[model samples]
Target: MSYLSRSRSVYGPTTSTTCLNKDDEDDDDGGGKTDNNNNNNADDHPGASMKQRTRIGTWNVLTLAQQGKLIQLANEARRMKLEILGLSEVRWLNFGEHRIPSGQILQYSGLRGENAPRHRGVGFLLSAQAHSALMKTRVRNLTIIQTYAPKFSLSYDAADLQDKENFYSQLNATVDRIPKGDIMICMGDFNAKIGSDNSNYERFMGRHDLGEMSENGELFAEFCGNNDMVIGGSLFPHRRVYKVTWVSRNSFTEYKIDHICISRKWKRCLLDVRNKRSADIASDHHLIIGEIRLRVARIPRQEERVGRQFNTRRLDDTTVKRSFTVELQTCAADIPEGGSVEDQWTAIKNAFNVTSENNLEERRGAKGAIQRSKTRGAIYSARQRYSALEKKVKRSCRRDKRAWADSLADEGEKVAATGDIRLLYHISRRLSGAKINATMPVKDAIGQLLTDPTDQLKRWFEHFEQFFQVPARPPSPRYDPPRVSEPIRVVAGVRQGCILSPLLFLIVIVEILVGAIDREPNRGLL
Candidate 1:
């Protein structure tokens, strides 16, 4: 079987259906099936058939602040059947990893500071499959140093020059960190047009590129050349609409500013790259997808967690509350009391768990149900209308179509602002590139960054243990006489960030110190 046909068998129509024919020289619509017989010597490349074909893409999602944008991005990923989606201009505050409700993992990096404005953020959204395949993640200044770069605007100010310098420096550092044999893809909006000229840059770029070369293009080409990376976007032949990545605000101009570049050594793995123009992402930039065929060893899947949460809201009802009270009284009365404190506590906990399980409804899918609202249909329709009008304006340069597109954009924003929150969320997600939570790296006692989640959790535990420990000291004498016949025994565990834990720890310390002071020889010091 040919590489394309074998890839199609694994990824299916989600990618292959829209693919441009590799064999057909004159194919223009960017749609043609791969012929297996065209490349009959498939066995020449040993182990090619065993390789899994993965689709990865990049997009410059202007910003990602509005709610529900992450979910929308995930939806788009599913539609494209992408394993990983690289994002630019995410504009989220700080660096972090957020696990969306849809099981996708989002890792992001941005400017750090409590007072920092949301700007120039970059991230990657991984499908569950990709998340499972992920070996590690490294968050740096701009690069996930594990997986990504942000977009640079087309400006030549002193600040822009400094920004470009810092970006390339960090990018170089990120590339250096990647281990040998690992696939590295550096993609984003560089705001540079390399044009169709491949003269000196024959190895790094291709003649299929669009527009005229800019100064930024030279810098970009130089970076790719130095890194031995292939600009995938420029290598593939596609229609004008499928080649351009960004369209002007007035729909009068378009540019292929966004690009996906892979290491030159693994360039053959990049089977195809093109602009997915029909993807309704609400951004001026189109989704640039690339297909890579790789022979990857399967990683063990993480264990799934299944836990029940009671419907505590049901307790608000008087009848429900009374019934729960009666049930708890009955269950508590039947408890045998000959066990240790821990055993007794466990019994009590079990009683509550059993009672809640029997009496209360499970809060399993309530949030999910709310998220899967009908507003998505409406938002999708609005986007489709906008896309249709955009294409019309581009083709005919019709003033009416351009005006209609602008009006639709305005109307969509207005509806998002005033209409259903779900609709607003979808719109925001469609506009914003990716949704990610702040996942600041934790450091151990020696200041070594803890990257593993397990290590991070352990560090938090160690921190709380030290934080809650009260120092032992020589006690001062007490004036009062002892009145209690028996000592009170108390067991306490500190839960970090809980309001009551600090108060409980303080009370425990006070009791212990007071008792010691009462038995001290020199009480005057107190």
Candidate 2:
């Protein structure tokens, strides 16, 4: 084949793998997320045990071209506690890793070039922990290759056939290149229903699958059989609700199109594969998470810093203030008066949280996670209500953020008139968004800049290790000192963050001075 033929995709050069449109493309009315009964699903635990398991999932978002969708999707991923999420129909141009503000890494492959039309794309959004695992995969070598395949069709269209062939052929080549020893996980929106019948293809899939085998299923089964990848989802038996990944926008009909498969050698490593309906990105498809039993290195958090506080300026509004006050009063009423300091603090924090959640972000429930029940009538009404609520919330948030900036600007102007340089500079920096990265990266032994967070942490650990090393001295008396008694447990009179802590400290110092003067009058103690 000529380079030109291989370079361009079936849907032209704009999109390489997935077709631009499919009947299963959208859920315009959206779908219900956050089902209460889904708590009993496998992989519900947060994998906080010695046997560190990683949660990897695949999703068909249809299109991520819209605003705020990616952030909402990321939040959903965090709530689902997924380590890695493969995405389809991302519709983002170019191929690269984009580290979002949330510290998650989004590594995507889309149409190449600046002018490439944003169409079908495949990508992986990795949590900080998951990215750390991928970086340290030498200890646990694992490779994941995801794809976005065209849907099955009735007509024998040449273009459609070409698209399907392109996906399978590319996938086959990619699978062939992987080492036999490495665990290979192949997942994505195949759009192929393998059905519940395990006839002839028992080795590749399980009989627990949903729906009837379609034309595309035959090809997918053949592909997995050739590759020796056992379908992870089918291997585990679960209710049909857990298995269903795609539902019609109307919330009536359902199908299982997305899949997660593991190479035969590591089939036992796949503990569970299920759909998380709660992770709604307003798409027809649900997030399919697979629990792979691998000891992943826990990614250490970055240096502790105060997180962004809420824009409290909104409380200045009378209606908002009144609502917040009422909610706070109700929440406070629920708290007991007598408790330990820690318990009381926690209660107060909860009270604040409840009030803020109620009044501050009023539009928060409008997003994809708008308390869905999955019924037809519920989903329809929810979608319509969400559509209207979403706009209102977005506009309200934008206005509030803008007002905060304006208030900062106004404060800066007043401070300028008062000649408070520090206040003016602080306000200016806050309003300008702090474009410059101020954190200085660490250096390796060779003095190369360690830009990756993991590498930087490693370098810092090495530095600290060498810095605290015991220095060799001339052989002095080798007598070991006698063990000292346990130190006294000291507690301060005033608690930290108390307004009168400094005042109480001064009072204590005054008492010491008074006692010293009374005991030994001016014995050069001054």
Candidate 3:
């Protein structure tokens, strides 16, 4: 099928997607050669290839339009352990790739206005899998080309045929452009259906197809065969449900139109392919997952960490404070006449760190809390027990923190009794809270604490909005007591020489005139 069927006519919202790839294309300096030696000359710095066993997936996420949904996408990607994920139907504007805050590289293409071109777009979220959290560099050559072809129409007209031809022609040219040494993967919706029959296409496709092959399927299979690419989804055996990549909204039909194919030279890399029905993104198509084993040519290097923090809160004790001061002084004395400024700074830094290490306690609760469970999302009874224990630990930590706050509050009361307002203010702040962490709770208008960063920002916005906008107040009530006639006095007349005399007289005259006008609406300047 090369074009959409007339029956599935364009009615509802079009699918928007994005594609992300960690693999790289050849640099212009390579002169289009596929030699590994030439690719390693430092100039052809390629991204990380799938040289190790890793999971990759593709899904047609209807749209990434909702607020805070992008993080959810990243979280799901992490949960699925997918290193490279190709997305379809991403409704975003602009086209390019950049590293997100999550360290994943997101590459995408979209149109300027409300709708994307041809009711489709490409997006990708390539996870940063380098072992070193500091140096997220990938080295090696590999390419993944994702596509969404025109549908197969009921009437095989010239336009439909021409569109299909254009897609395949471009696809063929793209596949030919990739460096031969670099592994190439082509996957996406092809609008085709190859039945279980794998007659002449056995070299590329297997006998595990979903349904009867359509005209588009025949052409698609022919295209793959000509390129020497093996269809990953068909090679593996799976239940019909697991094999189906798309299901109709009516729940009456299913099709495995989406496929992941790799060049025959790298066929051994693909371990398995299946459809995951549970990964919901408000789409009818199920997520297609594939496992591949790759080889890396370089080992990732990790950067060194420095100046780890100790529990300096212990320094609050008089004894500990005195001990730390003495140790710091001792260390400072040993700083042998420094060589350079940088060296002297380094020595001083080391002195402080060493003294703290020797005097203060080490912090362990947070590190232990995260490292306690290595196997994420494990559903075994052990996982349950670990979860329960984790909650208990958090509760105890909170209890201890509250107790500490209580003690600080009592101390603050004593300081207040001694008229130490500055210390009391600091203590009050500690007893309250600060935005030290993203997960810190902030009270909202309804008295509920909001932990979500977006919600907290909104609450703060509301507060600042009212705080900066001055409010209107009623004018002070004017009082005028009954006056009695008296002789004029000349004692206050000498003040006429003052600079403000004329301005003050003008203000009093204007005020009286305004009051007279208010009492008599017919009064005029005349």
Clashing pairs in 2: none
lDDT of 1: 0.61
Backbone clash total, candidate 2: 0
Clash number for each model: 5, 0, 26
Regions of model 2 farther than 4 Å from truth: 1-50, 130-138, 298-321, 338-376, 393-526
The top-ranked prediction according to lDDT is 2
Best of the candidates, TM-score: 2
lDDT of 3 by residue, 252-351 (tens): 5688888899889878778889987656444667889887764323234353543364766778889989999999999999897949998899999999
Q: How well does each candidate superpose onto the true structure, as a TM-score?
A: 0.53, 0.62, 0.47
Against the hidden true structure, what lDDT does model 3 obtain?
Answer: 0.63
Q: lDDT per prediction?
A: 0.61, 0.68, 0.63
Candidate 1, residue 453: Cα displacement in angstroms equals 4.6
**lDDT per residue as tens, model 1, 245-298:** 887654447888888887888677688899886565457788888776533223
Q: What is the TM-score of candidate 3?
A: 0.47
lDDT at 10 for candidate 2?
27
Stretches of candidate 3 exceeding 4 Å from the true structure: 1-51, 66-68, 98-101, 112-118, 130-140, 295-526
Worst 10 residues of 2 by lDDT: 16-25
Give the per-residue lDDT digits (tens) of candidate 2, residues 185-239.
8888888999999888887788888989987888889899999999888899999
